[model samples]
Target: MMSFLPQLSLPLPHHCSSSKPFQNPTVIALRSPTTVSNATTDSGIQFRRKLLYLRGLNVNALEALRKNPEFRSTPLRTLKSVETCLASMGIERAALGRIFDMYPQLLTCDPYLDLYPVFGFLLNDVEIPFPDVRTAIIRCPRLLICGVDDQLMPTLWFLRKLGFVGRQAITCQTTVLLVSSVENTLLRKLEYLRSLGLSCSEVANMVLRSPGLLTFSIENNYRPKVEYFLREMKGDIVEIKRFPQYFSFSLERKIKPRHKLLLDHGFSMSLSDMLKVSDGEFNLRLTKLRLRCLEEFPSAEVLLLNNLFLISVLTPKDWKRESSISCFYLYQLPLLDVFVYWLKILGCVNPLIVLDFYTFPILQFSSIIFIFLKCS
Candidate 1:
């Protein structure tokens, strides 16, 4: 067979028969074996790298991380320190998976500063019982994210101020302190309750009883409801102190309707009874006091006060004519007293206030109701 390919032999340069065969530049370069070896090594590395995103980074724990519900999704920037942080805290893999389930974000936090400091504070400063520390962390993970100086210490100090100050105070208060804020929550609620006439001791007892109240907002949750209790509902400080749960009830849903109903019927239900009753019970109590009684059961004469009655409703112009004092000019005691007797047996105060007609206006009616309910 005829060879069609060029040979690597000495066809020698035609012009100079003795000239050595010319070497191809490509072959000459290939002839330097180290270059071929280096090129092969470089290409092999490139191919290997392209096979995997993070080449040469051994993650024997990658399979375990797959079991972590959150760590796999955790941003690399945060995941780098998460396991180390968890391990430094002596958190085993089994427990860490559960922790991540609840607080996946904790995995991304700084292990040394953000993490150990918080753990140290809980274990050392606040002295959260070591056994209970896990439960507390499970309950509230922000201990990892929040700084001890700014967020945590202030809250601890406030909790201490709240009468968690005794030797057992830290143990008693650590859980709730981790859950709330000092400036935004605990402090504001304390100040507002004090403003509501809760004495220092009373406020302390209320907070110790229900730490969640401190989490309620001052402007939205605490203030408006408190104003309604004190100003509109005419509730006594003692009433709420006696029943601190008053802070928990929804104003729109519970307090307003019951209060307005009682006021319109001239009844004065105790604040505790007013807020605590279920809607069904409240409606049942209200139904017993007929709508007709609101307007039709006019105030009878004060003489019949003990008979569960009062005088008929009279216009302001005609009040002087029908006024118990006017009708019974023969009475020794004041008409207000007689009317007070009129509504007491009937379990309402409106008729008495109404009996004064123009004398006792809305605010005055509230005052009389307040004084009467409190005194009663």
Candidate 2:
């Protein structure tokens, strides 16, 4: 009976424990729950760090884990599946870091339930083409985090009602606007524009023409620009309705500088002419205006120095071909000297040239010089 019983390990007696406390071999052989739990936790953390490192998210992996609690417990395979899903939709491996960094909650999102539905809505409901699906996501990464039923569907409905359908339908280029809140963001901007003496239809037309109008902030962008347009430029609201892109131009950089330049020269330009052109083109147009001013009013020789300097800098081939003047001649000559030289060249061909400053407007003066230059 004793032999049949299993042999048991016994603890050492305190008296026979040599200098040590009595110990049980069985107890020493097993690990505590805390130790096992700690080992598991450490392994899980290391695995997550490796996963993020492999996916280019090492830059902010710890921050992501801390911020998104779901990420800490999410299975390794689930995180990989999210990456695989985005990759299938044309999101580049490099772009994944930036997207995840911006929205770390996406790390734990179920690909089928959370991510694929957004892609489907973009492709099917928004009518975004397959290739442009990547563009929309890259442009507005928040689109993935937004719920299709709560955020995206409601926004799309509001936009369609506001006349974003047909040719002016929301496309990949303007898909970023879809993430904006309908009550807090989109409607507020529309109502603000309407409050500025524009009818609802007029505001809708402006937004259709320039979708970026909806993105402008009321305090930072809309208020200041509208105030400047009315107070300083005395701009007509009708112009803004026709060219809503007027709001897109920087108030400090493009609007003020160009508007001041035109005011200094006693000239007025449409918002399109003032802002729609490049810096070089604007300078060329200003120089042309000064040239017209000089020819119309010979007494205004002061215009020549500034105008000639601009001509020297912005020397178009057409001017060189028309004048037959070398670059050195234009650069070196004083305003009066250049004016005299031009007159001498014109006198040879149109000896009977007449000056009528009062009859013709300053803008038409360029035609007179072109006529003489062509005849020569």
The TM-score leader among the candidates is 2
Instruction: Write one digit per residue (lDDT tens) for candidate 1, span 1-376.
Output: 4598776655555665465544553444245888889988876665344223222233323443444445444455565467666665555555655555455456545677667888888888787777677667656665667788988887787677667766537562346465567666666667888886668888889877766677677888887887888788777778777777877888998888878877776777777777777765675466445423433333343423212334443333333322232121112235557755755675643333322111122233211111122112
Over 194-251, each residue of candidate 2 has an lDDT whose tens digit, in order, gives: 9989998889888998999998999999999999999999988888888889889999
**Could you tell me which 10 consecutive residues in candidate 2 have the lowest summed lDDT?**
350-359
Cα error of candidate 2 at position 76, Å: 3.1
The C-alpha lDDT values of all candidates are: 0.59, 0.75
What TM-score goes with each of the models? 0.47, 0.72
Q: Candidate 1, TM-score vs. the true structure?
A: 0.47
Q: How many clashes in each structure?
A: 5, 0
Whose lDDT is greatest here? 2
